[model samples]
Target: MVQQRLFGLIFALVCGLLAFGSVNAGTDGVTAKQAQEAEFELGKRLFTKTAVPACALCHTLRDAGSEGAVGPVLDEIKPDADRVSKALRNGLGNMPAFKTLGEAEIKALARYVSQASGGAGPSGN
Candidate 1:
């Protein structure tokens, strides 16, 4: 009877482990590089389409294929992530504040711009 209980406990433990593994299976295969790429892609999408008026409408970014004449050329300026975040949140010069975007969205956009323009530090907002 004790052996049967032990076997049952082990079986339960194994089943629980299997269930947990399956639950995390989708994320277990993703590499750090893949996650970073996904983040960059998300930022690109926000820049081109999700943001109000769209960053592509006023910013010139070769990576995004935008040829806007209003904003400064990102390739030349290469503003860092913090600068981009500040400008996005509070507005800078002719740019309007993007109050609609959340902190995560701002961070992603900042990272994307900083990286794409060869700016230093893709750090947080």
Candidate 2:
């Protein structure tokens, strides 16, 4: 149990770090497998649907089956829940604010982007 918690913590921390560039990253530990899957599901919904200005219209994540290159490749960004949340909340460089999205959905998007990256836990600056 302790080991699981520790691994979760590490995963959360890594996700946060990668997602936000360590800029006031918050609320990690959202790494349960089920949660991750749910996040992926939500992300897919957001990506394909136009209701919330689908991500596919701008960015690309091959795993999500999108090839858009308008914005940075989401899969390459390596964002996690917190980092993803911050971006949605703040509207980074060119990605407009998705402030209407609730925290859960935003976190789900983060998880979706990070996991889809097909990469290990967050690393680097």
Candidate 3:
């Protein structure tokens, strides 16, 4: 009797583990908040320095102290990470392509823009 109970218990545990493991959920977003934090930090670094032309040189990021009229106004566009990422990686209109920033850097910069643009942070989505 003891052996049978132990076997059943093990089976139940295995089933529970399998059930939990099989469950897949959609990504709300980056798994770690710290990731976005780091990205933001890197972004701030990239934003201020002339790393990529000081985005301010041509675009207005009112909050970021940028007041260039050559590019579109940032606040009005309210560009999200995806849009910014795309723009960075694959430029648009008069914007120059930032293909050299690499995928991660571009993404981080996008997140920075999203936050700096007064939009929701990574925690928002």
Candidate 4:
């Protein structure tokens, strides 16, 4: 009987630890999600108005309510995050390089464009 009780105590302790760990894990997940959302919002803002010659001025992204006719329709192209990042960093045909923006800002912009356009592309650094 004593052994059984000890075993039960041990099991209960383990279960409690597991539950505690799960709670912590869940909290971490929530934090990560919130950070991701904030990053996306920043990216959206950059695309719309923050960036010099805002992306909205040339690119049409339905999500941003931009109707720019100069750049290709983002929804149709669905350019990946890498492609967007590269273009933003180095510039494409008519687009000038956004060299002023930091790497983090560039990444945020790339993620936003790719996600908004349904690119499903890999994340940029």
Maximum-TM-score candidate? 4
Question: Candidate 2 at 112: error in angstroms?
Answer: 0.4
Q: TM-score of every model?
A: 0.74, 0.61, 0.64, 0.75
Best by lDDT: 4
By lDDT, the better pick of 1 and 4 is 4
Judge candidate 3 at residue 21 and give its lDDT.
57
Winner of 2 and 3 under TM-score: 3
Alpha carbon lDDT at 110, candidate 2: 65
Task: Tell me the deviation in Å of residue 58 in model 3.
Answer: 0.9
Encode model 3's per-residue lDDT on 11-119: one tens digit a residue: 3443344446542333533224434465576666566653466677887886678788898888888788778877787788988887556555565677788888876
Model 3: worst 10 consecutive residues (lDDT sum): 23-32
Show the lowest summed lDDT stretch of 10 residues, model 1.
1-10
For 15-97, candidate 2 gives per-residue lDDT tens digits of: 55556655332444343444456446766666656326788888888877888778888777766656766778899898899
TM-score of 4: 0.75
Return whichever of 1 and 4 wins on TM-score.
4
| lDDT computed for candidate 2 | 0.62
What residue pairs are clashing in model 2? none
Error of 1 at 98 (Å): 0.7
Q: Report the candidate with higher TM-score, 2 versus 4.
A: 4
Per-candidate Cα lDDT values, in order, are 0.75, 0.62, 0.64, 0.77
